[model samples]
Target: MAGLVWKDIIYIKKMWKTMLFAVLFFILFSFSRNDAVSSMALIAIMVGSNFSMIPFNYDNYSKWNEYQYAFPISRKTAVCSRYLFGVIVFGCCALIYALIMMFQLFIINEIPEKEDLLLQIGVVCFVPVMQSILFPLIYHCGVEQARLYFVAIFALIAMLVIGCSSVIVNMFCEENTIMIIAAMIIIPILLYIFSLRLSINIEQKKMA
Candidate 1:
């Protein structure tokens, strides 16, 4: 497992330019001193899940699944590792971003309160769960279509929820921050579980 992961890192190291640029851009959000930075990291992870598409494509191109066929690892592990690696990649980015945020807050005086750690945590953990929601759909449907579906559906749902919530506030005028936050946390967990089950089923079919 370690070697497989290391090999991926070694491969990624050769492509540091693109990754560094992404890290730099995302870290720029850290200076804002808004909780939304954390949310943005998770959003970055969601977009970054597409990173798996390239490697998956490479595996198909090079016929590397045959090599996995020769190995003794379970098909479950095979599927799970790709997801694991994707998370790891995003986590690394989040860490660097958090550090940048910290520097911006402390050294640059942009944010006096040091909350980058909390923000990083908020972004990092739920990403795997988000991947659980996203990966299977992309895996089975293909990337281009899945990207279209995810962005469109998610944006529509977000707009509808925001619009309706605003209307409710106008009509009844009750603000429940706790309920809102709880719903945000709960929704991701549920989505993750759903994505995991879907991913496993699709992977099993592929192995079949």
Candidate 2:
């Protein structure tokens, strides 16, 4: 499983130029706008989650599925590795964005309020939820087919974030800060578990 995760990292490393460009673009955009903290965070999550698909593309190119089964690894392990890789990638991206936000705030001599930080955390949590939707489709339908639907997936995620943000704003009270934080942590985890199971089942069917 570690090797599998490393394999994905290698693929990402090969695309270093593109990744560098993306980071620069986002950084420039972040600095250009006054109200771009949340938007920058959201873009980081989206880009990082998209990076998770690179390994799948590499696998398809190499017919890795046919060969990977020759080893001791199970379909479940293979599927789980993608999720694990995604978590790492998203975590790194989130950290980078958080630092960027901090720098922005520092430059402006502003301290982030607790609620503002919580909102950022909440938005970050949605990355896994988007991945949960994306990974299953890629595993079951093939990456090429899944790529075609990415626009729709992007739209769906946008709608979900908008809806959730509205609800969070309306329902948030000082007392329920902990509750909101708990929900942000818990919901994405539940969704990931469900998605992992579905992905494992799909991979099993493919292997069988």
Candidate 3:
């Protein structure tokens, strides 16, 4: 796992733009009125920003996926690597956001425990769902084409999310927060499973 984590770190270091974007976005969110709003904003970036997506495609340009398939590592490891990359990127954004929040709190002499925790939850919940979409797109179309598709799909999701926010909140806002948390975690795991199956199927066809 250290080796895999190193691979992700090396990949991120080699590709600074995406990391920069996440940092820039974290800075943007720092200006928000509260941690929850700021955190949600960061989560929005995590879900919509595909800076890592290009590098993911680049990784495959050498036929890394094909080569990995030829190696002794299980396909699950290969698939998990891509998923892990998504988490790492999301963690970067979250960490940077937290740092900014820490600085801001120090400067302003205020602490917002509840809002900070909610934002953390939002960041944690958003990444798995975003990766469920991103990996499959990259797997089927490669990075460049997947990027184009990602843009369209991301915009659509943003629109859907915006359009549905009122409905979602109205329906679930007063409901048990535990149920909301459960759904956030469980639904994304289910979706990730579904996406993984689809991605592996696409990869197998490419191999055949």
Best by TM-score: 2
Sort by lDDT, best first: what order? 2, 3, 1
- From the highest TM-score down, the ranking of the candidates is 2, 3, 1
After TM-score superposition, the amount by which residue 149's alpha carbon in candidate 2 deviates from its true location, in angstroms, is 2.5
Counted clashes in each candidate structure: 1, 0, 0
In model 1, state the lDDT of residue 136.
84
TM-score of each: 0.65, 0.87, 0.73
After superposition on all CA atoms, what RMSD does each candidate show versus the true structure? Answer: 5.3, 2.4, 3.8
Candidate 3: deviation at residue 176, Å?
1.6
* Evaluation by lDDT, superior candidate among 1 and 3: 3
Candidate 3 lDDT by residue in tens digits, 29-104: 5566343453455455544356447447556675665565565766656666666666676666556656766765
| Model 1 Cα lDDT, one tens digit per residue, 88-177 | 765665576567667867887775332433334445554555566567877788666776786776566445534564353343334454
Better of 2 and 3 by TM-score: 2
Report residue 21 deviation for candidate 2 (angstroms).
2.1
Off by over 4 Å in 2: 159-175
Q: Note the Cα lDDT for every prediction shown.
A: 0.60, 0.79, 0.64
What value of lDDT does candidate 1 attain over all alpha carbons?
0.60
lDDT by residue for model 2 (1-208), tens: 9998999989999999998888888778866876454566567666876787889999999999778889999888888889999898778777776776777587776776666677677667877887888899998889988887875878776666555764554555354788888998999999999999999998899756
| Model 1 bad stretches (over 4 Å) | 29-47, 112-126, 150-194
